[model samples]
Target: MSVFVTVLSLSSLATILAALVSLADYHLNDYGVCTININGGTRTVDVNGGSSILSSLAKHKIFIPSACGGKATCGLCKVTMVDTISPVLPTEEPYLTAKEIEGGVRLACQVKVKRDLEILIPGEFLTVSQYQAKVEKITKLTYDIKKFRLRLLDPAQMEFKAGQYVQVDSKLYGAVREEVSRAYSISSAPSDRKAIELVVRLVPGGICTTFLHEHVKVGDKLTLAGPFGEFYLREGADHLIFIAGGSGLAPIRPMILDILKRKLDKKMTFFFGAVSRKDLFYVDYFRDLEARYPNFTYIPALSGAKPEDEWDGEEGLITEVVARNISDPEGKQAYLCGSPGMIDAALGTLREIGIGAEHIYYDKF
Candidate 1:
């Protein structure tokens, strides 16, 4: 036989073997199935034993709070390992403390379900379920921010705390092939259980925000889950201070409104910060509330105002304004929502004004 023919035959055989190997790996290398014993076997889920625990649980409609969408960057999907605990991974170290690691806590997004596992999550999470919602209205709040009112289609109504958040799941679009979920604080009063509102600011190059702004329509149906986060107002404080900037106003609005609607005896002062006149929004609504409710006060601040903007309110950074107006924060509870920088600055300012760290609650964007 000729050398060229022999070489050709060998090359063809090699390609065939490679194809057969791939086929076998796809069909025969299955991880089988494993059972997840949850909350002391109060609930058990049998699932394929290869994917991350986050994805596995999600498949069973068991949604864990994940701000970064299972990337393990947010570290919000932590679950206690009841049966067996894996060693702490480096990706999880930044969010976990030594004490947490010692307690067998792990980020569910980072843990692989290779075998039968036992885990523990909060009872509240077990109650959380996915909802079908239709966008009832889309109102522009500011140049970059928009308010979305979603009416619940399934289960008819939702029962979320005023300051809790929901994860909106966006359908695949453009380069995105799989659905994506992003957490946004609910801006509607809890009493309005049939519909929930969210104020979203457009983020440059953000997948979900881009989809929301450009593609979603007023009547579009969307999937969302939750009532997540621990940023709700606690009872018993005599005075309440709400400070927010940009879309951070979401949670604060519902909280303040709930207080006003219930005619709570507690006094509330809301400090809204903006870079200029155009950056501010919801001025009329809050102003109206303030006028009608004697215990409610609305203060809008502009840090950098143009002459044509005709702004007259607190000036300088929001933290500075908060510190200047509020003197004794001894018995006051503060709810702050803003960027990380603003949140940190506000925390420091609150600390300086005799406010205990325990009383200063915040949600950082």
Candidate 2:
């Protein structure tokens, strides 16, 4: 009788939770339609309120760079609201700094547009689009890294700067589970223009990486959105050093290709660091790049090489190789993309090698 009562209580609790979830989905997230005023009434949008301002704009085809896909982990989708908001959500608290809160900046994903709002986002976001695409090819680049070529099926192709990244919406694996979109840097050159390619390294149990590696196949249709990021090359840097590891190579490759194609005569060095020989990829491609440009060099370093590897290049930590290669970092700017630890190490190594904080630029993965 006690077990039966406990079972009944559990069932009742679940039913109540389901009902509340349904209610919130209906009432808190369904403000049929509303309007948004932007830049002092210079622009207006008739959008649905109740979903996050981020998602509502996205539903209408505005692309914001959110690494967490609205879970609010990346803190990329920040918007300034001059008008009132519902309240600060718990999910946004960690990502929000104190000054940001004081300035009326909120995580777009966490804020529901319950009423008409005036918000501030990048102008580039106004141009980003949502596309229906088909996976055309999937080829392994390294043991852990795979290259994916996606062809847009709907409004075919995209116009974007070389260093931007797009968010890939994950499809269900087996059960009827909803998946979040994951962002990755665009690897294909802008010259390709018609198709998109991404370099994805297999992450052990990562939700999106595992799905892309194990379940997705060629010809599978996927919904993707936007070329978003501010990691592109800024003018006036006469000398540039690009550093990357693992899948961080994606954005830097495209940026280099873009610079090369434009016939820009700039001194540049690309340092790619990996763990072993198998971990290294893109050697021949970068070799070709070096042949075409006199002022460019692609240096690949393996930190842990085996006896059979027969390697004689730089050894030890990647930061050590960086410090040895670039003797005078005083005048140059650097771009780093990798794990947070690696970025921190590189930034410290760069500064130790006499690079100013102002001369270093980074996009940490």
Residue 70, candidate 1: C-alpha displacement in angstroms: 0.8
TM-score against truth, every candidate: 0.91, 0.88
TM-score for model 2? 0.88
Judge candidate 2 at residue 180 and give its lDDT: 80
> Which candidate leads the pack in TM-score?
1
Kindly state the number of residue pairs that clash in model 1: 0
Candidate 2, 226: how far from true, in Å? 1.0
Model 2 Cα lDDT, one tens digit per residue, 1-365:
99999999999999999999989889776677788776677567888666887788777677777888788788889888897565678888887798888778898888887778888877777878888889999999998899899998777979888888899999878663878888988899988867899999988878888888888899998888888888878786778899888888999998898888888878899998998888888888899989979989988898898878888877777888888888986558888888888899999998888878877776654
Worst 10 residues of 1 by lDDT: 22-31
RMSD of each: 6.7, 3.9
lDDT of 2: 0.84
- Per-candidate Cα lDDT values, in order, are 0.89, 0.84
lDDT of 1 at 11: 97
Which residue runs of candidate 2 sit more than 4 Å off their true CA positions?
Answer: 1-32, 84-87
